[model samples]
Target: MALGLFWATVCLCVFVAVLSLDIMGFFSRGNKFQVEGRTVILTGGSYGMGKEVAKLLSQRGANLIIVARNVDKLKAAIEYAKSHAKNPSTQRFHYISADVCSEAENERLLKEATEWNNGKIPEIVWANAGSSTPMMWLESSIETQKQQMDMNYWATAYLAHKTLKAWLYPQTPYSPREKSAKAEAPRHFIMTSSAICFYSFTGYNPYGPAKWAMRGLCDGLRQEVLLYNGARRSTKKTGQEPAPFDINIQMVFPGNMKTPGHELENLTKPPITFILEKDDPEQTELAAATAAIKGLEAGNYYTSTNWLCDVMRISALGGNPRDNIIKDTVGQWLTSIVWLFVGPDLDGKVWNWGKKEGMPELKPEKRIAR
Candidate 1:
């Protein structure tokens, strides 16, 4: 009867609606971020926000393996991680000395870490290894631009690929425990890209290009992973799921940050070595240096106590970008449009961890002792 057909249709629609909601919720639930009990390998962990992240992770009972070129600082950071860790007995902290810019070093670091952990491969690898060039026009020598590209973009891309291919891939040497874990669950890949990957700045010079490449790297990698995941899901294959390898990439646009000098001795060297002159003595050199040191102590980009935390919070809460005509044109016409559109969203998405609000006044304990 017509009445009976209508009732059946209504029930079918309700069931479909409920199923849709459940499906949407399933994807949404997967996207949430959580960090605990994972083994994390962080480059540039000897200094700056990288060190702090490692410390925080250690507190959360995550094992840490830190890498940087400086052996002494790496050891110090490992000690710091151990000291700050909440459950030292369960946490594992190791330091590998390597220049992240070097492909060989990156490979060695990944292989050794995997081997050293008794095949307990790191679940998360943080490619936070970076060095900034002096802000200048792109007119600087080719060498300067090359260094920026190598240190920032190429180093980041190389390390990221190595981590994904070397450690995350199944065919490569895998620990027995890791293989068993993979049989149970997949892994995640995280990258610390910049918000600058979105917009252009007046002073970026060669640095902007380097960051843009990183943005591209993340986008391409994300798309590739999505495709792989989709293909795996679509396949009629039913048995055990393939290792769930997901790429979680975030381009963090931290405003200006007060980062400590990695190589103090190198900075102290003559300006001639860097192909640039030092700021005039009467200029605001001392004030600039002091402010940078203080900013790091306060952990503020602007005035916020934790710049990164604020960025992450803002990213969570949707925000809009200032529609600058010139910047928008540059973004749309010159570079990758995807990042240009997503850059603003990504700016505060992960965590600023830079100087956004004015930095806080430093107390004695916060001050770097001479």
Candidate 2:
């Protein structure tokens, strides 16, 4: 009878948890990311997931300005996005060719985008240009490490700094009463990070740290934006002209994607790296972008593109905002318990690989193709 009662209690607890999650989902059903009739600037939109995101945003009625280094690819991407526009005649689309890794180029791109939008800054800016070169730490050169950081972290940081300054500290400040309804809506700054940001593996030494830095930047800015958003609500008491609108900082953690960049990354990936991540599922550019857009619309601060990415994200959530506090807490607890065993298992695999293969050569005979 005691055993029977224990089982019944466990079942009741599970039922209650399921019911609570259902209720939470019901309450959060409405779309929080409203992009209709808004201007959106998307970086690295010439190909892959960025291009897919641009197409999705066009379907949702956003005016698009896609930025990339290749003018021909950027032109193609713009045409593709325009073809999918919800209101083809009303929705406008343009492409800009510039290397975003340069700080001056970022400033110039934003200025041109603002001018194109008729003196209004874009309502949404997504820093989606990033690359990876996977190799052992010792095998990778200092130049490769610095290039990784510049491409993945510094590029996004530069664009984000310029965009936020324009949004939060405009030269021509206007009172709350002077802004229109469209201008009063929240602005979004989305950063594209990788699943490696949450966990590091052997072959990612050159690339993982850069993504981790991007995650750190996102976390810090997420908290700092709260101060400005609060000031917007208390403008009367502070007697200062409020910033135009609330700024929402979000980040996307995408796992293995089937893109040209991913293909290039695989050319340099160590055999051990492949073995470690073989079980991780891969998503197409469209699928990954679709999942990211869904997460944004659901108002998630840190969006994960796949189940494995979600697991990694929750395991290292730190101070990031939770999508659902109860759900995230439960997930964190479960992930911690699983990691207790999984962590050692991974380490054992790496140890066994070294024992079986011995030390690999410092450099392979063939250099990675650019």
Please state every model's RMSD to the true fold in angstroms. Answer: 13.7, 3.1
> Model 1 — TM-score against the truth?
0.61
Supply the global lDDT for candidate 1.
0.56
Q: What lDDT score goes with residue 272 in model 1?
A: 30
TM-score of predicted structure 2: 0.92
Best by TM-score: 2
Q: lDDT tens string, model 1, 237-306?
A: 6554445555444333333344554243233322232322122122122233233223222322221123
lDDT of 2 by residue, 205-316 (tens): 9999999999999999999999989886673665455675889999999999898889888888889999999899999999999999999999999999999999998999
Clashes of 1: 12
Task: Give the least accurate 10-residue stretch of model 2, judged by summed lDDT.
Answer: 172-181
The candidate 1 region of ten consecutive residues with least summed lDDT is 276-285
Residue 19's lDDT within candidate 1 is: 60
Cα RMSD of predicted structure 2 = 3.1
